[model samples]
Target: MLVLTRRRGQAICIGDNIRIVVTRIEDGQVRLGIESSDNVTILREELLETVKQANQSALSSAPEAFNHWLNQQPKAVDDAGNTKDKA
Candidate 1:
Protein backbone atom coordinates (compact mmCIF):
# COMPACT_ATOMS: atom_id res chain seq x y z
CA MET A 1 0.00 0.00 0.00
CA LEU A 2 1.15 3.51 -0.73
CA VAL A 3 1.49 5.65 2.38
CA LEU A 4 1.61 9.42 2.54
CA THR A 5 1.07 12.14 5.10
CA ARG A 6 -1.70 14.67 4.60
CA ARG A 7 -3.21 17.39 6.75
CA ARG A 8 -6.73 18.72 6.77
CA GLY A 9 -7.79 20.19 3.41
CA GLN A 10 -4.98 18.29 1.71
CA ALA A 11 -6.08 15.85 -0.97
CA ILE A 12 -5.06 12.82 -2.98
CA CYS A 13 -6.05 11.53 -6.38
CA ILE A 14 -6.91 8.02 -7.46
CA GLY A 15 -6.54 7.33 -11.16
CA ASP A 16 -8.07 10.22 -13.13
CA ASN A 17 -11.33 11.23 -11.52
CA ILE A 18 -11.58 10.39 -7.81
CA ARG A 19 -10.30 12.89 -5.27
CA ILE A 20 -10.21 12.30 -1.50
CA VAL A 21 -9.81 15.33 0.72
CA VAL A 22 -9.14 15.36 4.42
CA THR A 23 -11.82 17.58 5.85
CA ARG A 24 -11.24 17.46 9.59
CA ILE A 25 -9.30 15.69 12.31
CA GLU A 26 -10.93 15.31 15.70
CA ASP A 27 -10.36 12.74 18.45
CA GLY A 28 -8.23 10.82 15.99
CA GLN A 29 -11.10 10.44 13.55
CA VAL A 30 -10.53 11.86 10.12
CA ARG A 31 -13.53 13.15 8.20
CA LEU A 32 -13.17 13.07 4.45
CA GLY A 33 -14.93 14.69 1.58
CA ILE A 34 -14.99 12.84 -1.69
CA GLU A 35 -15.21 14.55 -4.99
CA SER A 36 -16.02 12.05 -7.68
CA SER A 37 -18.53 10.88 -10.20
CA ASP A 38 -22.05 10.00 -9.11
CA ASN A 39 -21.53 6.46 -10.35
CA VAL A 40 -18.65 6.02 -7.92
CA THR A 41 -19.35 4.04 -4.78
CA ILE A 42 -17.51 3.66 -1.49
CA LEU A 43 -17.99 1.69 1.73
CA ARG A 44 -16.23 1.23 5.05
CA GLU A 45 -14.26 -2.00 5.46
CA GLU A 46 -16.48 -3.47 8.19
CA LEU A 47 -19.63 -2.68 6.28
CA LEU A 48 -18.18 -4.27 3.19
CA GLU A 49 -17.42 -7.43 5.13
CA THR A 50 -20.92 -7.47 6.59
CA VAL A 51 -22.41 -7.22 3.13
CA LYS A 52 -20.24 -10.08 1.96
CA GLN A 53 -21.39 -12.29 4.84
CA ALA A 54 -25.00 -11.44 4.17
CA ASN A 55 -24.64 -12.28 0.50
CA GLN A 56 -22.96 -15.57 1.36
CA SER A 57 -25.69 -16.46 3.82
CA ALA A 58 -28.30 -15.59 1.23
CA LEU A 59 -26.63 -17.69 -1.44
CA SER A 60 -26.05 -20.62 0.88
CA SER A 61 -29.56 -20.81 2.32
CA ALA A 62 -30.53 -22.77 -0.72
CA PRO A 63 -28.91 -23.51 -4.02
CA GLU A 64 -31.50 -24.12 -6.74
CA ALA A 65 -34.25 -22.75 -4.51
CA PHE A 66 -32.32 -19.59 -3.67
CA ASN A 67 -31.22 -19.07 -7.25
CA HIS A 68 -34.78 -19.31 -8.47
CA TRP A 69 -36.00 -16.90 -5.83
CA LEU A 70 -33.19 -14.47 -6.41
CA ASN A 71 -33.73 -14.55 -10.16
CA GLN A 72 -37.27 -13.32 -9.65
CA GLN A 73 -36.32 -10.28 -7.61
CA PRO A 74 -35.28 -6.87 -8.85
CA LYS A 75 -31.64 -6.03 -8.23
CA ALA A 76 -30.62 -3.04 -6.15
CA VAL A 77 -27.17 -1.51 -5.98
CA ASP A 78 -25.69 -1.17 -2.50
CA ASP A 79 -23.36 1.54 -1.21
CA ALA A 80 -20.33 -0.47 -2.32
CA GLY A 81 -21.26 -0.83 -5.98
CA ASN A 82 -22.65 -4.29 -5.23
CA THR A 83 -25.96 -5.45 -6.60
CA LYS A 84 -28.33 -6.91 -3.98
CA ASP A 85 -31.81 -8.31 -4.20
CA LYS A 86 -34.41 -6.54 -2.13
CA ALA A 87 -35.68 -9.80 -0.71
Candidate 2:
Protein backbone atom coordinates (compact mmCIF):
# COMPACT_ATOMS: atom_id res chain seq x y z
CA MET A 1 0.00 0.00 0.00
CA LEU A 2 1.23 3.48 -0.81
CA VAL A 3 0.88 5.86 2.11
CA LEU A 4 1.26 9.59 1.85
CA THR A 5 0.50 12.52 4.11
CA ARG A 6 -1.81 15.02 2.48
CA ARG A 7 -3.30 18.19 3.89
CA ARG A 8 -6.75 19.49 3.03
CA GLY A 9 -7.16 20.39 -0.68
CA GLN A 10 -4.17 18.26 -1.67
CA ALA A 11 -4.83 15.87 -4.55
CA ILE A 12 -3.42 12.63 -5.92
CA CYS A 13 -3.85 11.33 -9.41
CA ILE A 14 -4.12 7.70 -10.46
CA GLY A 15 -3.54 6.69 -14.06
CA ASP A 16 -5.02 9.13 -16.55
CA ASN A 17 -8.55 9.55 -15.28
CA ILE A 18 -8.89 9.02 -11.54
CA ARG A 19 -8.14 11.59 -8.85
CA ILE A 20 -8.40 11.51 -5.07
CA VAL A 21 -8.44 14.72 -3.06
CA VAL A 22 -8.38 15.51 0.60
CA THR A 23 -11.45 17.57 1.29
CA ARG A 24 -11.61 17.99 5.08
CA ILE A 25 -9.99 16.88 8.31
CA GLU A 26 -11.69 17.16 11.68
CA ASP A 27 -11.40 15.36 15.00
CA GLY A 28 -8.91 12.83 13.57
CA GLN A 29 -11.30 11.93 10.75
CA VAL A 30 -10.44 12.64 7.14
CA ARG A 31 -12.89 13.21 4.31
CA LEU A 32 -11.95 12.54 0.71
CA GLY A 33 -13.38 13.54 -2.63
CA ILE A 34 -12.87 11.29 -5.63
CA GLU A 35 -13.14 12.03 -9.33
CA SER A 36 -13.45 9.37 -11.98
CA SER A 37 -15.23 8.48 -15.17
CA ASP A 38 -18.88 7.54 -15.32
CA ASN A 39 -18.06 3.88 -15.98
CA VAL A 40 -15.92 3.58 -12.90
CA THR A 41 -17.33 1.84 -9.83
CA ILE A 42 -16.32 3.14 -6.43
CA LEU A 43 -17.24 1.24 -3.29
CA ARG A 44 -16.19 1.30 0.34
CA GLU A 45 -14.13 -1.74 1.40
CA GLU A 46 -16.62 -2.96 4.01
CA LEU A 47 -19.56 -2.58 1.63
CA LEU A 48 -17.67 -4.42 -1.11
CA GLU A 49 -16.92 -7.30 1.25
CA THR A 50 -20.58 -7.48 2.27
CA VAL A 51 -21.64 -7.67 -1.37
CA LYS A 52 -19.10 -10.43 -2.05
CA GLN A 53 -20.33 -12.47 0.91
CA ALA A 54 -23.95 -12.08 -0.17
CA ASN A 55 -23.08 -13.21 -3.71
CA GLN A 56 -21.24 -16.27 -2.40
CA SER A 57 -24.15 -17.25 -0.18
CA ALA A 58 -26.61 -16.85 -3.02
CA LEU A 59 -24.46 -18.97 -5.37
CA SER A 60 -24.00 -21.73 -2.76
CA SER A 61 -27.75 -22.13 -2.21
CA ALA A 62 -28.80 -21.78 -5.85
CA PRO A 63 -28.28 -25.35 -7.06
CA GLU A 64 -30.19 -26.95 -4.22
CA ALA A 65 -33.04 -24.48 -4.53
CA PHE A 66 -33.17 -25.04 -8.29
CA ASN A 67 -33.31 -28.82 -7.83
CA HIS A 68 -36.15 -28.50 -5.36
CA TRP A 69 -38.08 -26.31 -7.77
CA LEU A 70 -37.47 -28.72 -10.64
CA ASN A 71 -38.79 -31.60 -8.55
CA GLN A 72 -41.99 -29.71 -7.88
CA GLN A 73 -42.75 -29.28 -11.55
CA PRO A 74 -45.17 -31.67 -13.25
CA LYS A 75 -43.46 -34.52 -15.07
CA ALA A 76 -43.61 -34.47 -18.87
CA VAL A 77 -43.30 -38.26 -19.17
CA ASP A 78 -44.90 -41.30 -17.47
CA ASP A 79 -43.20 -44.38 -15.96
CA ALA A 80 -43.70 -46.25 -19.26
CA GLY A 81 -41.97 -43.41 -21.15
CA ASN A 82 -45.15 -42.14 -22.76
CA THR A 83 -45.68 -38.40 -23.16
CA LYS A 84 -48.11 -37.09 -20.52
CA ASP A 85 -49.58 -34.06 -22.19
CA LYS A 86 -53.01 -32.75 -21.25
CA ALA A 87 -55.24 -32.68 -24.35
lDDT top scorer: 2
Estimate, for each residue in 1-87, the C-alpha lDDT of model 2 and write its tens digit: 999999999999999999999999999899999999999999999999999999999999999998888777776787889866432
lDDT assessment of candidate 1: 0.90
TM-score of each: 0.67, 0.73
Mind giving the per-residue lDDT tens digits that candidate 1 earns over 1-87?
Answer: 999899999999998889999999999899998888878878888999999999998778768886777798888999999988776
| Candidate 2 off by > 4 Å | 69-87
Q: Model 1: how far is 64 from its true place, Å?
A: 6.2
